[model samples]
Target: MLFSFEFSPIAVATLTFLLAGFVKGVIGLGLPTVAMGLLSTVMAPAQAASLLIVPSFVTNVWQLATGPRFGALARRLWPMMAGVVVGTLAGTGFMQGSHAGQAAIALGVALMAYAVLGLTAMRFAVPPRAERWLGPVIGAVTGLMTAATGVFVIPAVPYLGALGLPKDELIQALGLSFTVSTVALAAALAGGGSFETGTAGASALALAPALIGMSVGGWMRGRVSERMFRRCFFLGLLALGAHLASRALI
Candidate 1:
């Protein structure tokens, strides 16, 4: 068994996964953001990140399979994939660097920045000519951020948004991107010896709650106001970021 109700860690991890999945169901993203942010409050950052691997991977794979198509998006985003691997590996080396606290603060800043971007009515356009250069750069930084704080939605999502694809295509691309990010994270954890079969087992078991919460959120999405839900999500993220930043900096 993963844990008994008597253990607070199990309860916290389960709730965090459920909440993250719900957000993803409603908004089509933010699972990692929610999971990482909430879990970080209760455990070491790397351990929290390790816990996210199975659930994120499973959910994103489901998203990708349900989408219209795939290989093309994966090919297009290859640079981002490469960057994620490299950046994550490099960032893992600094798990106990003197700047660890600073890295955590950067994570909080990244989250708040993403929240602000979501709240505003701004979108960037990276002309195809520029995307060739920008895609990998954004991916690498996202990987770095993921390694440091377990969050991976900053520049990647915004960058993907700028592509100006059809709604379905954008969603598909996000699934690919997130899947790559999750894999890279898992690899980094394995490389650092922070992830093991036992951890993987716990993460797999957590998938039940995550999937269930996603179904509920999916049902609620049709009944709720997406615009309002988005605003609330960003606001909640802002508050969480503030808390994380304060904890790290204080």
Candidate 2:
């Protein structure tokens, strides 16, 4: 597909990435949700996912390198990376033959479900034994969805949240997870006959706006209460979910 941007779509996409990144910066999550939801309105889910790859990589690199708890991050990295690789392979395989619209709808529903779960007052703990296994499961699922849709990270976030990890640790984990998944996804795309030069250029073009958003959102993280941030995030997910679901059904 030709990706030459007329001014209007470029402006909209730029704003969307900015907002998505801002949310991610503050909360240490939600960038894919924000970007995929908004971008899907204008671009195919595959296209949107591709656009996010570079920016997510850049931000996560910064977060993992400079964020606190590098030691813990190092310890957990291997298992999570394994999950990301496995998941990406699965998702990429699925996407190679699947319909993009179907993938978008599925991703949308997953995001909405996650948002609803977050909004719930009920909280539960995962046993340590369970967590070891659960990490890969979530990672695989995230990778698959990420390969299929732009918003694959949703499945892992709540699980991490429920682990009662410190805020900084959770952020680090997410950055690491995204990095691994994106790499795997990129490899899959290269092999799947879907990765094209034009698409990659478009993705690179979109990265700047996404980075801008992340910067803004990171700044807002300190200003908001946890409760407020969670609430806003939930609402955004719900809205995005509704839009994707609607698109699929229509």
TM-score of each: 0.93, 0.88
Off by over 4 Å in 2: 93-98
CA displacement after TM-score superposition, residue 189 of candidate 1 (Å): 0.7
Per-residue CA lDDT of model 2 for 5-75, tens digit only, reads 67887887888878878887777777777877887778766666767777777777887776688777758
Please give the range of 10 consecutive residues that has the lowest summed lDDT in model 1: 93-102
List of clashing residue pairs for candidate 1: none
Task: Candidate 2: give its CA RMSD in angstroms.
Answer: 2.3
Give all candidates' CA lDDT scores: 0.83, 0.74
Q: Compared to the true structure, candidate 2 yields what TM-score?
A: 0.88
Q: Residue by residue across 1-250, what tens digits does model 1's lDDT show?
A: 3222347888898999899899999989998888878877776677777789999999999888887868778778888878877888778844334655765677678788888998994788889888778888998998888788777887789999998878998898999888888898888888877677888988898899899889989989999999999999999989988988899988
User: Which candidate's lDDT is highest?
Assistant: 1
User: What shift in Å separates residue 176 of candidate 1 from its native position after superposition?
Assistant: 0.4
* Segments in model 1 whose C-alpha atoms lie over 4 Å from true places: 1-6, 95-100
